[model samples]
Target: MAQTGIADRAARNGHAADEGGAGLAGRLLGGLARQVQQRIPAADLDERDPDYIRESLPRQWLLASLWFRGEVRGLGNIPESGPVLLVGNHSGGNMTPDTIVFTLAFYTYFGVERPFYQLAHNLVVSFPQLSFLRKFGTVAASPENSAKALQAGAALLVYPGGDRRSLARGLGLDRLFRLKVLPISLALPWGINVGDFLGHIPLPAKITVEALPPIDLREEFGQQPDLDEVYDHVMRLMQDTLDALAAERRLPVLG
Candidate 1:
């Protein structure tokens, strides 16, 4: 009888362990699903409407041109056709006016009919109310989406990853894809538009964006160049341009 009871107890514990494991797995999967839902909504592409962009240009232009007194130079430097990658600095902390100014300049110059897309942070794209962004070809930033846009021969705008990563991609991707990497520089409002993310009154601070000459990576850095060497070259080139822009600024901080 004692032996039989011990065996029964052992079987019951084993059964409970299985149930506990299943329960734990269910919780983990449930948590992961929720995170996925909150972070990466299954909406990478397929919402861009040329008509919507055309209709919206007037409003965006008004804000960019009138309020910010924005100026974008070197739009013509961008190739008139084909897949082009625009990589620029995110100068404004929460209120990235450079993006708006550049977008307006691109659309007005190229016309809304040409396909142009920008990769946005997941936090920005996940909001349901910001669905209008999708209409403007603003998709969640991902390698897959970037590749898809480029492969489709669309003008894709991407912010560099990080210090080292940014340099690596700025050149590496260009060499791999045979792209002309356009580096952008911007000077935007300071005080009034400081809290750009939360919404603040812009001071008409005269935002200026300059698109530097497109760098053909393989042509400039050679077909097989060291990433670190390429990075240093690009950094010096951008920093010099930034310094020049600052020197030309009338309202150094505000603009």
Candidate 2:
């Protein structure tokens, strides 16, 4: 009888686990569905409709509740369609706050649930618990994954400096690396727009996002592989966007 009771308890726990898994799946699916519902037509995006605000308000509210306030400006510039590249500074600390906060802002302000598929260190995703982070759009930041996302018309966020620069032992503003250039190069030929955000200067940091004019690769690419040339072109565009935003210095800290 004691053995039977133990088995029964184990089975009950399994059922509860299954129920919890199902609930989480439902929530993620719902979030994605909401994104589709809130999508503005490619042409009508110029209107800068407030529908994005409506869809994104909940996320902002949650951020507020967490006492993790930050500003996310420059919403008017996001392209309505096609693949887009987001290159920014990476934080070396565990689970960079910049990545998470910026993602929340994008979802809340833009009404887009497309999570930033970070090109994480392979070791991070290889672990079982951390692998689940992929559902939130974490991916190995490899050339293959980058190309795949662009092909699927997904927006990608990258940190050119990697963790080393953001979490540098000694930092006096080193140059931004070009790791993201690989993804940007792939995105351009696909007519993907590139965006850059600059901000997050420590705890009391603010964010400024800027959208660069889409790299015009249709004229340059004749259905061929000119990766080096493409990389330079995309890098220049990203650099221009970041430089512009950094100059503005409009940091708005939310309470």
Pick out the ten consecutive residues of candidate 2 with the lowest summed lDDT.
185-194
Model 2, 1-255: lDDT tens per residue? 643443344445452222466655544455454454344222111222235544655765575335444445554455655566665554344445555565656666555444335555555555676544455566655555655555556666666553433322111111112222222321110011122223322343443344444443434553343545655555667666555655555444321
Listed in order, each prediction's TM-score against the native is 0.73, 0.47
TM-score of predicted model 2?
Answer: 0.47
Most lDDT-accurate candidate: 1
lDDT score of residue 12 within candidate 2: 52
RMSD of 2: 16.6
Report the lDDT tens digits of candidate 1 across residue range 1-255: 643443344445452222466655544455454456455544445688889889989988897777777888877878778877776665645556767778878889999878888877786776776778788888776655776777677888876646666646532454444433333222222222466555564456777677767766666767765677766776677677777767776765566
Deviation in Å, model 1, residue 84 alpha carbon: 0.8
What lDDT does each candidate get? 0.65, 0.46
